[model samples]
Target chain A: MKPTTLRSFLPRPAINQRICISRVSRGYAVQAPGNPTLQVFNRNTKYLQKERAASNVERSRQADYLKDEVAMRLSERLLDINRHFNHVLDLGANSCNIARALTLPDPDIDPSKTTSPPLSTRISHLTAADSSRTLLYRDVDLPFNQEINLTRQVLDDEERLPFEAETFDAVLSSLSMHWINDLPSQLAQINHVLKPDSPFIAAMFGGDTLYELRTSLQLSDQERRGGVATHVSPLADVRDMGGLLQKAGFKMLTVDVDDIIVDFPDTFSLMRDLQAMGESNAVLGREPGGIQKDVLLANEGIYRELHGNEDGTLPATFRMIYMIGWKEGPNQAKPLPRGSGQINIKDILGGGEVK
Target chain B: MPTRISPIEKFAKAAAKCSVESSAYGKCIVVDYNSVHKDKCLTEFLRLKNCYLAAAKKP
Candidate 1:
């Protein structure tokens, strides 16, 4: 009862948040809904039809949430699965994965049932916005396009979002938000979006990803050269990421990390997947602009030598963390009426106090 | 024995976020919760989300 504080929850999302006012802005413009300046809204009518069809497919799709058995076990100890949310926001909801996995329209439950409300009935409206890799993907039906809205907009790390504070029921992100360099400020913006007692859920790759690649490059450089060698860009650690969440004011914080080994037959296959997914690291503070081929080749060689086995295929480890936190309400409350255990029925009977 | 947030209080918070300005209307009265959202109201409104998810998994 004492309005469960942040300590009671798991997977604090504030770790990945980064908010900052930008002196530099990128190519941006608003395309009118119809007469489009950009091609995103081109086939609005066609999109509506495709969206309708996609929803039919989504109704049956079982969302693949997590593969790690340990993460699944840890998550059971973390999330308050029964807590009902009203206003949910999907921050950087690429392909609408997490939203389909969670959210219910009729939160008030019948108690006997196991599943949430159906896709059509649950989740009042889910708004999924991301800077379009192609404006074409907006209506492009992939897998989980259900009753949701898509938009093309750049998220400012420092400034407040277009929406008001304490408005969303819950804000969720999966495999996104780490791109932000000013992660702390973004966490505050997430806090600003939720109403008191709301929750934020998120998942992101931890810093340990590509370590074999990083380490191999470092050792090779040390042996032949003096300086540290550049390899795969690193991710944030789970403990450091969690500290950022606490600083963002999210209570009941919890973070869980899962080590997933990814096998790549070759580097080109891995790079292609990264490009299609728009996952090339975009950290703003990197030294300079432009990529080189020789450096990349050397880096790959180093990574392979460190993590490869006799089979020749390379192994890359990806650590993913899922976090959550609550927007603290005024004055936490405790259940069972504070200290109601002091009274004794035997004392009342002996004193003849029965009415 | 406890503080139970009224259903209406909880619902209004959920409903108010979906209330947006009508694109067609002039600034006369921008907030358009009535006509624009009426048909798809259940789609974004909590009154329907619970039903869809709870039944989605059932055989």
Candidate 2:
């Protein structure tokens, strides 16, 4: 990968090694709302080298922490949504969370295999792909159908997937895929890998999810300065997500937003959680960790005034979507078309029509 | 001293065991899910490889 392309590509930080240094159109001058050009802080090369030297062990430790648990549940969920999958591929399967989810037995497993596939029935082959070598090597000793890590990005538009066309039975990406700068292009690449009847699932963070906090920050920024620059890069809406999946040659697409409301002792705890998860938005065009201590305080006040309930615990919302789509193929079931003729309410009532 | 499994090894084992259905890894994971160890089950499951606890709360 060219340095330009590699740097330009949206980063999918492995486990928790996410640190983005933002350099706007101008040099050292950064552009964020409420502040014309904030100073680039803490992310200097020296700092990074120091950080790397300091916490190289911690970086691996973080990856090691949740390997088994994530894989189990993810495997289960994948199994539930995808029936009759012979081959499965997991993208950036960090500690294999979705893979773990896929492993869980399907609730709809047929008893006695009553003219149906048995429950917790394994896929014929499983493939795990990621850019992290430490993570890639972790799976080397483990038992997988066949794990592939040498291949960097399955969605490489230039070469595409190395696997044969119509090869994979299913493809699942959880909390990843959004990191790609060219998401649509990558999605198209993924479409290529999956067999026509395969299932595609992606669980990702969406725009309206952290509305309370985002809105509060915006308001505060406006109050502090004349205008605000975009902080959080918006996610594909539910409708767009479904359309994207469908356009990627998928059918039977479903996008369900799982709104999880979390209670925090205060806003600080929520921010801490986001930090711990390495989920801080990294819009290359946007500025990093806000400047102006007073502005942050003002933002906090705004958040408290608007979103804080009487209990003093600020409500934090994460708008997440559990989406699934099926690859279009000859064997795939076609969807039924809706009748174009409008319904007649008066005729159906019969009270209005004597006949 | 007792055996102190490295967190990396621990998580790797967990992820492998979690995602595998009938794959090579599944055979190793004896999901000791029983009456007394519910939270442990949940935590262990959450910790499973690539298994995302989407709606999981801080217990």
Candidate 3:
């Protein structure tokens, strides 16, 4: 599929289509009430479905560049926990990357002469869910375990999960949830579906991701276009992850940032890589015509001056934030109630007895 | 909710008044929206934008 701009997907005008100009636009006499702002990253599912389909095709060429690495990292976290996950749900499981990584037989334990249980034995069932049916159906063969049962479902939407309460032992999403507009609501749904004390681990791009590209684009656009437009989608902040987990009633929440930098020959190559990875800008507010040639050429200079290496290659940073939360249950640890601690902080600091 | 000028129309309007400005790095056509529209209503904005695009050379 060809790379798309905002104008490429704009609905074609019908002959009888009614074009209503707002009253506010009639005369500027009295300012009409401003429309409420939409939630950031609030994109239509149809656009995403199409975009993901294109991306899945490109993913074959780039085979495991960013997605596979992140999925493996997320899978390793699950492996380290040493807990038996009977049923695992890979939310936003595009092409079952996470599921495949999680269920593949451990390299250390050979199935032919395995004295110990393989990693595939830990998870009996894997349900892979994604918004794009194109992605789920594109590839038929999977490197999944023969013993494990794998099911694929096209989710209705990210904000609303269709599953019974306490259905999953673990829920994992790799570099997918950042596109969601209502993250807290999504987290609540994930929390509801997870069995008590079960784990929910996710990895997503962080706020500082692609700062080099963003700065260059803004500067180039401001200089050439008189004003800057939204060229890149905003990523989630690491600090906000903890609060969101708590709001969703998840306990033992942990959020960590992993920064990865990839070197590129130039801005053009970098942009090509983004296109190949299916990570190009798709936000509604992005420029309709896409990046102008001049802006891109100008950005190359700025990119090299600031972020370039001695080898004449530039760097692109991808900050992945890993978030882990556990569903609240009787077995989960709880914080101490107010004034319930045995020792007072004042006594320990002052070396004096408490009253 | 009241409808506003869509993003496509806004981009086209911005592209119309564009003039190629040369810099140290390169040159690009910069569209000055403030100079063109000032403070127009949504309806007026779209009308004036269509007119501007119709008259000006395509960016």
lDDT per residue for candidate 2 within A65-176, as digits (tens), equals 2234333434545545535667777775544455444444454556877554322255555566654434334334444313222222322222134566777877777665
Q: Pick by TM-score: which candidate is best? A: 3
Mind giving the per-residue lDDT tens digits that candidate 1 earns over A1-355?
A: 5675776476746533332223134246666564222121122322232233234333213222232232233223324455544445667655454444432233344579776453323345555554332322433465335443333343332123677877787776666565545567778888888888766777777778767655644543442333443435556688887898888988777687767777875444454444444444343333343233323333344444445556867786767777877778776432466668887868867967558
- Candidate 2 — which residues are off by over 4 angstroms? A1-84, A104-121, A133-164, A289-291, A337-355, B1-59
Model 3 scores what on Cα lDDT?
Answer: 0.70
| C-alpha lDDT of all candidate models, in order | 0.49, 0.52, 0.70
Let me know the TM-score candidate 2 reaches against the reference structure.
Answer: 0.57
The alpha-carbon RMSD values of the candidates against the true structure, listed in the order shown, are 27.5, 19.2, 14.9
Candidate 2 chain A: 10-residue stretch with minimal lDDT:
A38-47
Better of 1 and 3 by DockQ: 3
Q: Give me the runs in candidate 3 sitting further than 4 Å from their true place.
A: A1-38, A45-63, A104-118, A145-148, A336-355, B1-59
Off by over 4 Å in 1: A1-79, A100-122, A133-139, A147-160, A217-231, A284-291, A331-355, B1-59
Question: Which candidate would rank higher by lDDT, 2 or 3?
Answer: 3
TM-score of chain B of each: 0.31, 0.31, 0.29
Per-model TM-score versus the true fold: 0.53, 0.57, 0.70
